[model samples]
Target: MNKYIVKMLSVNDNNAFFQLINTNRERLEDFFAGTVLRTKTIADTINYCEEIEQKINKKSYFPYLILEKESNVIVGFIDVKNIDWNIPKAELGAFIDSKHEGKGIITTTMASLIDDIVNEHHFKKLLCRISSRNTRSIRVALNSGFELEGTIRCDYKTTKGEIVDLNYYGKIF
Candidate 1:
């Protein structure tokens, strides 16, 4: 098994977070859309980190950095955002650096986090909205116990301005 750890994103993680996103920019653009495209400069990253810190304090979003245990390297990110307190649910998003892809690290990490989010965080449901073209992410969601709810046609506009369908998967606790 791969050794992995997941922790809440912190302001002090700015450098490691910037490096992770910078190195994975090209690959991340394939699915991340507007989010990753905005962080081209270190200043942009610092601003983004500050935004995340604010969200954390407000309890509006929870972003976590996925790290390799042995090397303590930032290999990926998994976040639960768009939190709705009334519904007590959130949307899930994740990406692994291309260099770290195909290692089952995200699967392990998410599986563990799901439990914490549901029990500790008291979220009643969690959902993942994935690009239909992203089969790997769909599989990861399924493997992590999210059931396919449905697909929304032309739901996402890529950074390149192309419209794409999205697969919605969810788990209800």
Candidate 2:
């Protein structure tokens, strides 16, 4: 049996989804400011989930909830955003529950999703923009078959109001 199941984010996932973001707000605030800041309440999560569904239907963003099969809880999330249909590429983003970190769950799940992103989604390339200081995520990108493309200086300001460089990693399918 699969250890994890990846389901598209839906409105019904509001509660568990909010809990996941709330539980890791501190850890995610630095790099994942958009989600951490936007989803501060269950109501906020409901709105965000609705927005995600709209984006999915518009073919602009695809977000998946990673469910741990045994516990049936949301253990992580993966997203394909910034899609450029012309280039047929998208940027990938992901975060795992703090409790489930370093268990190879994100790595394995990402590897599998890479296949789907290419074969099923018909994406020509996938990209991951990771903070220069986040070695864990850089390793995840490398281990999942992405190569360092370049670095963007002062990519964006974090929720803490600190600017950080982002390392661009990409895999061409």
Best of the candidates, TM-score: 2
Where is model 1 poorest over a 10-residue stretch in terms of lDDT? 30-39
User: What is the lDDT, from 0 to 100, of the residue 58 in candidate 2?
Assistant: 95
Q: Where in model 1 is the C-alpha error above 4 Å?
A: none
User: lDDT of each structure?
Assistant: 0.88, 0.91
* Residue-wise C-alpha lDDT for candidate 2, range 3-84, written one tens digit per residue: 9988888999999999999999999888778888779999999999998889888989899889998889999999999999
Model 2 gets an lDDT of 0.91
**C-alpha RMSD by candidate, in order:** 1.3, 1.1
**Cα lDDT for residue 62, model 1?**
91
TM-score of 2: 0.96
What's the CA error at residue 57 for candidate 2, in Å? 0.7
The TM-score of candidate 1 is 0.95
